[model samples]
Target: MKGILKKVYVIFFISYFVFFTSWFPGLSFFNNSNKVELNDNVKLQAQAPDYWPTTGWRASSPESQGVSPQKLQEMEDYIVSENIGGYIDSLLIVRNGYLVYESYPSHIYDANIRHHIFSCTKVFTSTLIGVALEEGYISGLDDYVLDYFPNRTFDNMDYRKEAITIKDLLTMTSGIAWTDQVDYYQMAFSYNWVQYVLDQPMVHQPGEVWNYNTGGSHLLSAILDRETPNGTLDYAKTRIFDPLNITEYSWNLDRQGIPIGGTLLHLTPRDMAKFGFLYLNNGTWNGTQLIPASWVAEATTSFIDVEFDQSHGSGYGYQWWIYNWLNAYTARGSNQQYIVVIPDLNLVVVSTGNTEYQFIRLLVDFILPSAGFTPLNLVFVISLIVGTISLSILLGFTFFHFKKKRTIKKLRKEFFEETDSNGETFQ
Candidate 1:
């Protein structure tokens, strides 16, 4: 009986571990931390107009900000029905520079966990290049790419490769022979990324063709590595991330110590929205100009026309994706990670997910219509999500807590009773 009780205790602890670690039924008890908060979101929008969100995002309701709560609910429902929210870590919607909607699915993932944004890191590298220009680490985009690598010897050096400019790499028109399908993994495995990229033979003349070259992005990383004041990651901390108050983040490095520029940037969903907000505000945060407005314009504009996905996007900008939609851009990553900016709407929608679905179209379908179609009446309604957890969730947790305790108490009584009944206990 003593051994049996010990086994049962071990099982109880194991049950605790399993329930808290993964998303299982009733994990909401462990996941929910925020107490119920109720208020009108619109009344607080401009309480401090100069706010930069350096601390954290201020929560709001969609309806208070002229967004239809019902439609937002529809979008959330679609995400659940399609298993979209389950695939992603977080989904956030910001309108008029206010965070109106946010949802995190898995119990493990919360607002604080910094996620690997994957290819979305490409645009950040580009943004850093702009900072490099501002800080005078780089002279201009028209400068030769080879000039940044004077000491590194290239056996395959030629006029076409030498003609490659900072601009060339920015637009993926470096024309360097790179098949991202195969070369990306190869480059990640190799010890010397710069050499591997510089070694690739020039298949087309510089700025002649738009090829999806991951090598080109790695080259930008190498360039920043050499040219910037500190390493690229350190420079990012001071110039981009810190300025935006993105204090919690991790930039993964290659085996060679090169920070993966094309991908490998990690940020929380709210921090990612700050980046979009940075671009949306034309690189200004609060009153300071963090990135040049000119760079923001050039970086988001269609620099080249490349067809993709059978439907969206007219071309690629410096590191951003310029879609066919008016004044719209996105920083996209593999597995459907997106930080989408709609300049026309003054809106930013962010998601970090695993599935490859058009979250933007879903936005257009569900969220966008609610923003403009509804008339703005100043009446405030009680928010459905004002409480962090619903009454059912609360009751469920209470029931489960008491039930576990009662079961454990019953087990203890029964075990001792059975042991006493045996009359073989000498202790």
Candidate 2:
């Protein structure tokens, strides 16, 4: 009996140790005692203007403020009530250049944290294509896919495949009958993802119809890699990231070592806001032309009208999503992450969430309406205060719950050992 008890105790201890090591390698690192302090100087410095202003003023606000307080409150209420899958993490509203409103859900407020942008990477990738075209790296958007890959050959290669142009891929009319469900991650990890995508079976004529193809965007990265002086990443650094002051970010690569243009770019919420702001300002930032104004107009302009409205009430524009709201355009990712840019309204709203289809509705019904429409400043202030307090209480409960669990676990182990010892003595 004593031997059996010893074996059980040893097994339990080993299992717990292994589980703790695997699941919480540095649990103490996250404790309040070791928490890193944020620099006070880096907090948002933008001040609200004395008077509620209209659009295009650029005096009190960053560029020019638009929307009313009532509308902004409506939006916030909608997001909170929707309870979209993931926490909203962070939301920022930039009208003109000034930061109008910003919020960070209790669990996700760090400025340096980079959340996965998913399909929004396509918008950035498309922007790079515009840069490549402007710099004369390639001839034009109409350049054939075959021109970029001379050595790589395709099976059933016909005029349709040969005739397929870079523009076709950009517009998602590549004529390739490929579904995104196939172990595309594995295929992308292959030594030649571009060749694999090109070799896909042709279902229709090039540019005949639209098919949302992530692989198509990867081909853009491949083409960029072939034509640019350096690689696509280097080109992006020089043309996009560097100019925008986006230093800390990451783009995942395919098996062939090319940045996956379709998805998997990680960026801080603020940096993501910068991208939207660049588009909002017509590709100009801080008095410098980062992206060509012409490209900004062209990219956001509806290139293809998707037949069905996405759950988010958005249409597709050259990798950008067109909001149902008065011609607003956005860069959207899975789980409701959005970089919404309303050029007509001079508004940019960035939100990250894990919710399902309702996120779009939340944005349309709630967030956008609140931007500039609320009646009284006191109401907004009271609501914000209440919301903050509620969130803090919720976080406190979560922290205490975990701490109790840890203590209970320790107690259970001790109790079990004592029970085993008593049982052994009786035997």
Candidate 3:
């Protein structure tokens, strides 16, 4: 019995260590290797025929060139105060292909930091759909879901399952009942995530009502894997990543060796900015039409009305979020990460923040107001200046406080260790 107990203890320790090690930081299991290499002499450059304006200066200017600086500052402050989630890592605002403003907060600012983009990975997944269709791997958006997955079975094994289409998944109207708030982290760790998602009971008829379902997105990934001769990641590397010049990145794969389409994509801020720029240019990069133009239009169009409270106010498109402001649409993630595109102003604003609701509120209340082209009021300008100064001070103090807390924790640990040694000696 004693020997058996020792064996069990050893097994438990090994399992725990393996699990933790697999999940540790800086040891991502995803593969993001670029499969295709371009000629060394070939140089790709951004081709913007005309440059956007960047004029006007005031202490609290309502607008600068096209977007308001005061409003941008206000949004920044709100994000810091709310303590959103990860970090307000990077922000870049571009107008007519010219960079207007860019910022990287001190806490999460690093050239090589690849932030996890949660469900924002859906946007990339959707883009792959467009690529597959354009490349003739997919017949059309109307192609039935079961056409690819002939062997798979659903809860309602009927013709209704046949009604599920690529478009249905993109629109989030697949009629599949799914809970987004559930602990998906545990589900991701399971050995059969694809089977688990597919086996979910159908709650309604296909395309009856709009429902936000991440599982549907995974189905799309499965479809891509089936249709393409090469693996999904390899296809993305050749078709998307190679063309965009993205070398460093990672994408999570499920137990079935399929990319987890709904979430967990890690990318550097600069590479993320490239994606934003690609969409802003209407699927064109460096004058090359990488994705079909019609697909971009269709993808950004509102397919379902989303309930946006203080946290978020946007309609859902093909894995994209369409905002009511200035006919803007964005690829957004939890905790305020966004790549907002406004076609009218020819502007693209990319902001990564930790604060959830406060960041959205700031964008609506402060950023939008300041984006107007009109002149500013004197009192408003002074207030904006004061607010900027105060917010800077607050950020400084917050960082200092966090540092002090870490110091105290280290000291306490040392003191406790000393006390434990003394107690052992007394015993």
Candidate 4:
């Protein structure tokens, strides 16, 4: 009876283990300290905004915007506990065109302060190119590179260099023979920045390879300067900034007085989100189309499949990183600056962190799930409930079986003792 009960107990535990593991495939409840508890069947109903955030954004509670406040709190706590609090400049989440969550973790930055958004400036540069195309300042994406700089003669002149197009530059597949780490520093110190970029020898045919070249981005800025009235900075001030009411911002210029297109644009976190919101609403701000709808769609679409070995992206669009899993896109920069837009969720997340942390992990593991995007699996829930009930029944059966056996053994021992005593008395 003891051996049978022992075997039954082992079988019960094995079944329980199998059921538990099957219920949560990827997540181990005992292993991960920060395991996500499912908020089952959460349907996000976006609340329409009362007004456009052209002048300033309206504030709303996370729950009101169909965002989980508990998840946001967990994200904040993770930042603090990870010792990333000091380096984090700002973190803001915009859902349904309202500012749902905002945190200045570093305590040094705020809504009023402008933060330097490094390579995120590239996305803005790409946007201006779209604007210029719409306004007829430039001809089209297929226009050759050499045609733009007709006055200047370039070195290593080949058919490949002549074949480079604006679209090639926009997608970072210019095929220019340049190492970003070495060449970018050299280009920065050179006398004529645009001339230096244009003069680089063609390594591969344009649009055949994807290489990160900040110099190529600067070439874009120079092109804008030539095509647009007054220059890139002035053109942006009139066309983008003033219209969006984005006042109090700065742009750093190159040696040739063209705005450094790859980096060095500063704006407040709120203002950074406005650019994201503009893209989210398909380039429309308020009732007016700030950027052409077609341009926004084309810019965010992945043109090249590149690998950065990061959670944020493995695909590249026109100056945008595509997160295919989330069906989102981001204007990502070094040191963890990002303007992530999830169209499906009607969400925009902006962060300017001086220190590098896995912001994508936060987005995927916490934020997206918190937005109630991942619904609980019905099969798993049903199995969990059934397994718990079965285990309870098995435990109760085992307990009663042992109790009944003990009772029978005690009665038999008492009967034998009485029989022995009566037999001895008769003798």
Best by lDDT: 4
Instruction: Supply candidate 3's per-residue lDDT for 413.
Output: 83
Model 3, stretches more than 4 Å misplaced?
Answer: 1-65, 73-87, 154-156, 183-186, 309-314, 355-357, 373-427
- TM-score for each candidate, following the candidate numbering: 0.74, 0.69, 0.68, 0.77
* Ten residues in sequence with the least summed lDDT for candidate 2: 40-49
Candidate that would win on TM-score: 4
Per-candidate Cα lDDT values, in order, are 0.75, 0.68, 0.67, 0.82
lDDT, candidate 4, 362-398, per-residue tens: 7876787777765233444555666676667667877
- Collision count of model 4: 0
Per-residue lDDT for 145-207 in model 2, tens only? Answer: 888889767877877888899888887888987887673665666677777788787888988
- State in Å the error of residue 123, model 3: 0.7
Candidate 4 TM-score, true structure as reference = 0.77
Order candidates by lDDT, high to low.
Answer: 4, 1, 2, 3
**Model 4 global lDDT (CA atoms, 0 to 1):** 0.82
Candidate 4 C-alpha RMSD relative to the actual structure: 11.4
lDDT of 3 by residue, 128-156 (tens): 99999999999998988878867666554
Cα lDDT tens digits for candidate 1, 206-314? 9889998878997898889888877899998988888788988998887667688898888998999999888877787888889988788888878889765445567
